[model samples]
Target: MIRALNLEDLGSWLLKANGMTSDIAEVAARREPVRRFCVRPGYRARLMAAGQPVLLWVSGDRRRVTPGIWAAGELTGPALVADGKLRVPLELRWLDDDRRVHRDTVRSDGRLADLEVLRQPQAANPSFVTAEQMAALRAYLPDGCGWTPALSPRG
Candidate 1:
């Protein structure tokens, strides 16, 4: 059964891209207007929704591409089931090679060391990123990338 994601639970997410299956360099070079990322079917995929922030993590050593967060964007729409798979529409806000955050860097940070992607390397596509982790990652992003956490009601 399909369930609605809780708005209060919304936060940053990590979407892994396999370098062997996907040409990271080509995708980064194209700077496509919009892209659809597929996530493994399960609870995690069901939690995804439109307007939530997303980070594209390039996985695998293929093409000599360093594995890490290569891009940041927002989900343009809710998860859609196509061909028996779940896909989320994304619109990238930042995708600069210089701004790429390497896995080593993230591991070195205490706040990001326990990231789901790092903990379970072979985990499914959509990985959860806590608000605190997202804040820590913001430090690595360059100024004017237009990345800002969604304000809370209490704030």
Candidate 2:
């Protein structure tokens, strides 16, 4: 299950000394360049030691009137302070070009509205998404949308 996380909401979600830890164990279990990022140093070290791959979902800023998965990235190097805050190095693959997916589409589509993660107060932090939810999100993608999978090589 992919975890739906708030990228800008730090009040509810906490990050490690370096980066955020994975809420899902499967993410840590993967190998060969985990398709994820912003992991706690310990977890990141563990994955590095195990030679695993991590996948992370970055939520768009709701305050900025943006919502939905914005991008996914693979951790590359140790976390460092950039623009004043410690940040993990990542090669990000953007999921969407525009922030069109909103509460309307989410509620209008039976597949999207059925997602349990989104059912709660959107002001909360990162939440888990079942495989069915992930599939539904993918299936709902409009034709010719610029969105791409997290694994794809970013242009």
Candidate 1, pairs of clashing residues: none
lDDT of 1 by residue, 1-155 (tens): 22233335435778888876777657687876547888888766766766678888888773478778888878777779877878988877546777888888999999988777888878777776776678888889766444455523211
| lDDT leader | 1
Using TM-score as the measure, the top candidate is 1
TM-score of each: 0.82, 0.38
Clashing pairs in 2: 33-53, 34-53, 34-54, 35-54, 35-55, 36-54, 36-55, 36-56
| lDDT of the candidates, in the order given | 0.73, 0.36
Error of 2 at 12 (Å): 20
The deviation in Å at residue 103 for candidate 1 is: 0.7
Q: Model 2 shows how many backbone clashes?
A: 8
Those runs of model 2 whose alpha carbons end farther than 4 Å from true positions after fitting are 1-64, 73-91, 122-125, 141-155
